[model samples]
Target chain A: MPDLLSPALIMIVAAMAIGPAKGHLRTAVLLLAPLITLWAIWQVPDGVQGTVKFLSYNVEPVEGSALRRLFATVFALMVFVGGLYAFRLARWYELAAAYAYAAGAIGVCFAGDLIVLFLYWELMALFSTVVVWCGGTPAARAAGIRYAIMHLLGGVVLKVGIEGVLISTGSIEIRPLLATDFSTWMILCGILINAAAPPVSAWLADAYPEASPTGSVFLSAFTTKTAVLVLILLFPGEPVLIGVGLFMVVYGIVYALLENDIRRILAYSIVNQVGFMVCAVGIGTELALNGAAAHAFAHIIYKALLFMSAGVVIYRTGKTRCTELGGLYRTMPVTTICCIIGALAISSFPLTSGFTTKSLISLAAANEQMVWVYMTLTAASAGVFLHAGIKFPWFVFFQRDSGMRPKDAPWNMAAAMIIFAALCILLGVAPQWLYPFLPYPIEYEAYTAGKVVFYLQLLLFSGLAFFILLPLMKRTETISLDVDWLWRRAAPWLLQQGSRGLQPLLVFSASTWQSLEALSKRMAVNYLGQPETADSEERGLFARSWPIGATALWIAILLSAYVFIYYTD
Target chain B: MSDSDSQDFLSRPQTIRRLWWGFSIVLALTVAAQLVIYVKGYFVVDGWFGFGAVYGFLSCLLMVLAAKALGYFLKKPADFYQQDEDDA
Candidate 1:
């Protein structure tokens, strides 16, 4: 039997009501729905709660497990905090779309079948495109179109894979599949596309920054992390993922290092951070799975905190490029402090959420004796500090005074930052709160003196490198090419050239057809032995009148030819 | 303390110098912690003295240099994609 009130349904219904609800009533629903959803999420006991047969397949809409509960809980909390941050700023439709997007994420957390999961997945794709368009700029519109196309393509790939699996196995159940056949490999490809794996990874950096400030905060929290959650559920211990994850880790850091836009830097680092979770899922140990899940949870908080701080800067200063911003700490002290805290958390400094969660993956690698993966993750940790941790706050808030004294984040925005900031520390201090929610038993401790010292040394040295290399890392108004170049520049250019190249062929074909029609008209006029009338010329080739006797003669001649050919065959 | 004085304090040269000194001390101390803490290394190279520090520094340097080299080929004006829109 289906539960009467699932957590995702509350938000979905609230999203539907937002268009009609007005003023204070809208605000109340926006704030209260997530709180209510959180309450509903907790009330759900651990099992399949909502199941129904659809199209001759049993579909379970709500499957309660610790992992699902953990993801849903955070997604609900994200909606509340993100709503609070955006309440005073965003247009009503943006808020509605964001709530619907959050609902889709929540739905994915509890989905028990491929059909139900694909439904939620498409729902997210639709609403998120609206949120991107809500930026109300030309760039946002173009980026939103590209974002939609990429996701729709991804959905088609995923749908094809799901159909393949259903046909092959005669079931719609979502289960871990070895990448042993075409169907499973297709399934893995579909999920990794959302994980921002390379070759298609440019979409995240392309679209997220074009979103309005508040839209980015919601955008940052859900999509890729949802992809990570699904990966942990479905494709654990796939060895090839280790190489893919490593490439993403290095790719993100390099692009972030070259980035000039403040949010784009953070966006690239999101790929970097998700790289850690992907690598962990690749490791596929019990500890590794726990690490991937825990890291996704921790990453959502800190990354949103980073984006919130960036949003405040953009909202106030009307600038986003790092070259155009600096010396913000003097006036915007609260934002600076909060941004620094977020930086520390992302860098995995001791006593922050990242310190508690990210180490689990590294330890899993070490335990498995995957020496190369372990060392690469260690270096990427420092590189994270270089690009995101120190570089973001240093360039945006503390470098040479840009002499702009914008006000700090307004009260609601500050409250959102403060709440996530507090969680960053609280999770670090008391990881026990988060540990029990893992898919496996917690057999690791995070706060060892030796590990702390090692990370401190690594991160601090990377910081030293940042200052030492600061001259080379100066902000510039330049964009770096990614695989998007094929579509953005090359594909359009190729199409234009292709059309230009075909012009002569088209002209020749048209003229030749015109000549053929003229010849046929002359033949008809001569053979029929009737004077050509004005109407005959006007009627064109196919519509020109011919005598019945002449047509019968032509048909008899064609029949004679056909009879001869048949006899020859 | 007055508002101007607080401003004077942060903007002062001494503040910069003091920050550098503190930075150096912290770096030294982090290096010193290698003696006090025993890190279990999964690989032979990772176990060497100050492996993480040297590796982090060198990798960061290489990354910055690589980005600089890549910028030669990949970097374009911010309005690069805007060209597509204008043509369309």
Candidate 2:
């Protein structure tokens, strides 16, 4: 009811409260904050509801739309569920940082202007880095720093673009723009970096798997999905995104296939899954936009579910590498079933949320008659089944027995995963509930007999291929090099090499400076007739005293020369 | 527990064999179902009978092989980055 009451404020305030609250009080704030935020999100009416004067511009902090509300609602839901999963086990600081991170994401959803959006974008970056650091390992500390650097670089580029747009158009209101000029292109690049688009996507796989399991569930949901939300809001129908999205699709599969870390594989598939949404946003039809939005919502749920399951395994067993894990399904039945559901959803298997939501994007491509894009997407869908759908669960849960029995997820974690797993099936079976909330009116149906048959053949055969290629898919304790290698390895190596190569030059320069100093001393001694032995303690020519008369005479000559030259010129 | 006692039903050799047969049958059924339901494809090649099955299988094969090949070049010891940490 109050003006300027953004739901982001509620979560942030609760985050502050959580830092000091203890035990039951902390639990109460963690659970209640998101519920209240969800209510506040829905309470906002359509269009811009709040604005304030800042500098010469009117800063709109709260705007409500069907799309914005959809994203915000899901974010709020994620906070509650993620909090429920983590509160019992996670450190209080992690909960606080995760809450603030969720607040930033929700803030981006309702940001009415680019300025507010950028601020929230940064808030997400700052707090998500904290969540990453909560891994409490040296690797986590390093990865968090890298993640921070990458996001901050992206934020600067985005800020520059926002400033450019403001100067050019005199308006900061969120609106669609093509990447036709410098500013829009900068904005696209900025968003793509967060979207984990190629050439810089390694950050997702690099930082995420390193975070604490509970921390990762929060990480998985916010930053990249917020990028998708902004892409939907700002740069729909950009042709370049098609190519960028396709690259991400194939890249995710290949890298994930090569990965052995359980969580890293899931992290790579996050890029892969987001690739579907990015491609949908590129397609930019009402249907494609709806697909992107719906896929993001479904992706956040299922992806978090996948991370939650992986987190439980990591929590129970200290090992993280696939080479070190198997037969988990025997002891951790609940985690296994939940992981399978998450995997099925990601694969777009029939009667799953992925099928209901992802089909819309392929349908949109087909409708537009983009045959190559359609084929690529269809194949990528199958690839998703191979790399994430079957590969993740097989290696982590059902393969050769590792002969170790670890306890399943604790009660709260189980409850969290079950809630998301149910949502996956619910949305799959009854997408009609999700359809009305999409930004566009719905005309497509997901459960056609033909579609079901087609998708089943596609995904199931991919399953067959996975089993057939089981020998080739053997896990190794290794990581694939990505673009981050340029910064992480190559750049540092180059700098080391450069310094090595410059060793002679540095020595030569030092000797040359020494000679110059000696030469100056010799010249002063020979010309001025000063005793070098007397000035030996002085060490340099400037350190010796000179006669005032000689100095004055030299100054008079230099002044005369300057006057002569000036007059002649 | 002994090996026999510890082995779960799902991991037993006989059950594994049965699972393979059952999985094969289900895969065949999915392709077979396409005969009764006419699948309209946006592209000419996709319209071919069992296109989804064949394409999906081949795509995954290519991706697996590609990843394996890439692993030769891209794969590094798990502690590769950690070695950098040591150096630092």
Candidate 3:
């Protein structure tokens, strides 16, 4: 009853209804659920608290605070809308798994203990793979297999770190660690891998677009954002992440700039968006952490909004690549406008959601006098506008006007996008709506002439560069190289070569064993002559010693007699 | 356990042309609201600025289009991995 009183309970219950309930009931479950969830989440008072325990571990499954509660609230809302968008076309398993996955993400938001967080963390991993596998394409199946392996490896590393912390510190509270120890860094890496930091970045673009449209929408929301949330809670002030985050920031833009598929470009941009949050967490100031959290908050809305547009395109035309798709603004005008809103928000254009929030983190870098990090982040901001903010909407909606326009998004799909689009603008227009919920008080201003003009000029110029350099940047039918190449291409190749290299060793061992066997048999025969055995001087000098001794004695006796006679004369 | 009883609901492909049109109408309303805001003193700009901001918008737009053109060419076939890889 305590949990049921919460909106998270209602939203999840409604999501479960997507799979089975017949006809109109499913429709009701789809559309009205998110609203109800939003209402219930609104009612959860500040400082509302509850807990449940098992196995001598007290699990703070629900600690109701404005911050934790808001994240959970958004997560629930994401699920309901995602459910509405999905349940119609998505398979039962995909629908069911997505709901369970959302619950896990919301579960983590509410978890006050590391143990509970770990449990939910693994849950997110398990169900997301199911969603990816639900793509049902051959590509989906292969990508899903690889996706599962990568996440499971990440989970093992995380679990090892958790166990190490539990053994050494004798606690499992979900509090910030300075990342001083091996265990902590391992835990951070474990989480960062999910955040799609370097080296493991290939798994995301490799997997997500292969997923069914509905699944991609769900996949985009949870995993990396949860990593950001964990970083906010666990390693808030670690400076190493600044360098790491910067690398991911620009990496996403360049790779995305090179990407051809609409969803995959957005996929790379997710890492880039997460890099902002990662940097904020690295800055570790209250405002910076809030920026990270608020950015995560707005990010979920805008990122999901972009995915919805792409999903709509994929659904109508069954084409996902930017090359195959262009000039849809002619047919799908509504989708175009909504996607533009999302794009503007992600680019941090003045008066959009991204404008209000992402700057706080970047500003924090500036205030800290971290000039290199600041410049890197600023260029990355421009890069965001270049790759995702403009590129996504332009290719899918406007561009050369590909002359084939199906219908706009379905009611559920449009509704989801509209709701998110509203949030993106609402928060931007009035920062107070999202500000208080941040981990830190945001005393910063989002709308200054200097700042706005600077961002615009940077983004505007980048746009010019993209156009000016257009000839060099042609979309060849190729995927840009990624860190995942190590596993997907390089490791598999090395494995083949390694086996090739071992062939000689195998042959040498086989021949050597055979020769040794023959030698052992010859020795076991006792004598080479066998039954007619004769041992002779051929056995060597040790056997012939007595003949030489007898001859020497006779010679010595005669030599002594001759010597004595000579001496007497 | 049988959904055949609800066959009418289950079988129909659901023509949402009306719904789609309705949502578009709503979008028009929002765009109108923005137009209204522009009309009133609360407006940030004079209007959507059809050709007035042409260079700014076009420079941004064409830049995106060209990048997109390149992206299309750069895009590997969906089966790019398979082209280089054989399971054996």
Model 2: per-residue lDDT, tens digit, A1-569? 37577889999999999989998999999999999999999998899987788776799989999999999999999999999999998999999999999999999999999988999999999999999999999899999999999999999999999999888989898999999999888999999999999889999999999999899999999999999999999989988988888999999999999999999999999999899999999999999999999999999999999999999999999989999998888889999999999999999998899999999999999999999899999999999999999999998998888888999999999999999999999999999999999999998878988888888899999999999999988888788889999999999999999999999999999999999999997887765556636646444455556799999999999999999999999
TM-score to native of every candidate shown: 0.91, 0.91, 0.77
**Residue A329's lDDT in candidate 2:** 89
Tens digits of per-residue lDDT, candidate 3, B1-88, equal 1343224232223433554456456434433444333321112231342211232334444535544565554455656688665554
Model 2, B34: alpha-carbon shift in Å? 1.8
Using lDDT as the measure, name the better of candidate 1 and candidate 3: 1
| Candidate rank order under DockQ | 2, 1, 3
| Tens digits of lDDT, candidate 1, A269-351 | 99999999999999999999999999999999999999999999999999999989988898899999999999999999999
For candidate 2 chain B, the 10 contiguous residues with the lowest summed lDDT are B1-10
Model 3 alpha-carbon miss at residue A330, Å: 0.9
Judge candidate 1 at residue A440 and give its lDDT.
92
The C-alpha stretches of model 3 lying farther than 4 A from their native spots are A1-17, A31-51, A504-569, B1-78, B84-87
Ten residues in sequence with the least summed lDDT for candidate 3 chain A? A536-545
* Highest lDDT against the true fold, candidate: 2
CA lDDT, candidate 1, residue A264: 90
